[model samples]
Target: MDLSSSTVVENTNDFRATSIPTTINGLRFYHELDEWQQDNHFIRSGYVKGTNSYKSSFNSLFYIHNETGNIYSHLLPSLVIAGSLVYYLKFQLPLYESHLQVWEWINFLQFGFAATFCLAMSSIFHCIKSHSHSVARFGNQLDYFGIIILITCSLISIMVFAYHREPKFKYGFSCLFLVLGSICTFLTLDPKFSTSVYRPIRSTMFILFGLSGVVPIVSAVNTYGLEVTKRKAGLNWLIWEGVLYISGAVLYAMRVPERFSHVEQDQASLLNNPMVGKFDIWGHSHQIFHVLVVIAAFCHWKGLVQCYHTMHQDMLA
Candidate 1:
C-alpha cells in the first residue's frame, strides 16, 4: 500500500478503517515492536509495517504515532535547552562583576554539552528506530553513550565545581565515575543485554553507577556540616534529582502504569493480562520514563545553579 505523504489519522475509526498491509511507506504506525524491528519500516503504524527513507524518518517527528511521545520527549527539550544555553552565555558577556572565570565558562559549556548531547541522541534513537535493525541498534548505543555523558558530566560539575575546596576528592571521584561510566557504556554496547533476560542486569548497572554519588555526598556533608551542606551544596535539590531518577528507573524496569483493554495486540498482550495493553500510544512506562528523565536532568541543572550562586557568594565573602 502507498501511504507516503499520508496524514496520520488520530481517530480510532479511520485508523482501523485502513486495511493492514504487509508493507507501506514511512507514514503509518506499527502496533508491535517486532513489526518494525524485523522490517525496515520508515513509519510503522499500530498494526502495520511500512518502509521509509531517511527523509521520512526525519519527518516522523511531526506525525502522530506510538513513538511520538518518546521522540519529542527528548527532541524538543534538546532544542530548547541548547538555545537557552547559548542565549545565557551571550547574556553574561557584558557583566564584569557577575562574569565567570574562563575555566568556569568552560565547565558550563561542558555541562551543556552533556545535557544537550544526551537529549539529542535520545531523540535520534526514538526517531530513527524504525529505519532498520542496524539503525535501531546504533540508536541504542548512542542512547547508552548519552547516558554516560549525563552521568559523567553531572559528577564533574557536582563534585569539582560544588566542592572546589576539596581538590583531591573532587577530581578523584570525578575521574572514578568517568572511568566507571566508560565501562558501563562498553557493557551496554555489547548487545548481550538487549534480550529480556538481561534487561534487569542493564538496569542494575545504571542504578549502581548513580548510587556511587554517595561518596561525594558523604564527603560534602562531612566537610560542611549537614545543614550547611544541605543549603550550600544544594543537597536537597540533588536528593530530589536522585529521587526522580530512581523513580524513572523503577518505571522503566517495572513497566508500571501501562494498561490496555485491547487484548488483541500481540506484543501488549503477551501476558494475556488485560491490565497492560491500553497504553500503547500514551501512558506507557517508557514515555513516562522519558518525561521523568527530563525533569531529573532539570533538577540537576537547578542544583548546579544553586551551587554556582553559593560559590559566587563564597568568593565575594
Candidate 2:
C-alpha cells in the first residue's frame, strides 16, 4: 500500500469508537470515536481530530503532545536555578556582606524568582495551549511574558553591575529599566508575528534582549580595565556565552542535518519529528536553545562573581 493508504489503515486500526464517558470542565461529554491517538489523554481532544490511538506513545514525560513537554523541560531547570539562588541569598549572602547590600541582595532574589515564574508559564503555554485555539492564544502571551522575564533579569544584572558604586541609584535604575523593557516586550506580542514568516523578527527580538547585556559589559570593561584578572574572567564568560547562544540560534534557523535529508527524517527522523522521544528532548533545536539560555545566564553570574571578587580584593588591599 501507498503511504497515504497505510496511514489511513493505521489510523483506523489505532483509534476505535467507544462510549467512554468523559468529563471536561464539569460537563459530561461522550468521548468521540474519531479521536487521534496521542501520548496524553488530556491533550487528545480539541484541535486534534482523527481516528487513531489517543494513548500516549512515549513515557509520562512524553504524554503531553505539542511543545508542553519542551516548555516543562525548561521550566524544571528554571525552578531549580531559582531555588538555588534563593538558598544562596538566604544562607550565603551574609558571607558576602561586604560585596552586596541587603537591598541589592533582595533585588537579585526577586528578579530570579520572577524570571523563573515567567519561564514556567511559557512552558505551560507550549504544553497545554495546543489543545485549543484560545488556549494557544493565551500560551503565546505567556511565551512573550517569559521573554520579558528574561529581559527583566538581564536588565537587573546590568543595573547591579552598572551602579555597583551607588546602591540606591542601582536599585532605582534597575527597577525602572526592567519595567520599561518588559512593557516594550509586551507590546510586541502581535499575533501576526507568531507565524513562521515572522520567525526572523521573533528571533531578533530575543537576540536583542540577550544582547542588551553589552551595555553593562562595556561599562564594566571601561571602568575596571582589561588588565584586572576579574575583568578578564568576565570577558571570558561573555565570549563563551555568546558562542553558545549564537550556535544554538544557527542550528534553529538552519534546521541542519534534518533539512538536508528530509526523506530520512520524516516523523522518525531526528530533524522533523517533534516527538522522537528522549533524544529529541535533549538534543533538539529548542532544547539546545534552552540550554544556551541557561549557559548565558551562568556566564553572566560568573561575570558578576568576578566583579565582586576584584572589587573586594581592591578594598582589602
The Cα RMSD in angstroms, rounded to one decimal, for candidate 2 relative to the true structure is 8.0
Return the lDDT, model 2, position 14: 32
Model 2 earns a TM-score of: 0.66
What TM-score goes with each of the models?
0.81, 0.66
Please give, for residues 233-268, the per-residue lDDT of candidate 1 as tens digits.
Answer: 678888988888888888777655652233333332
User: What's the lDDT for candidate 1?
Assistant: 0.70
Candidate 1 global Cα RMSD: 6.9
lDDT of 2 by residue, 191-281 (tens): 6655545556667666666676565556555766656533533567767776776676676555443233222222224333343222322
- Tell me the deviation in Å of residue 135 in model 1: 1.2
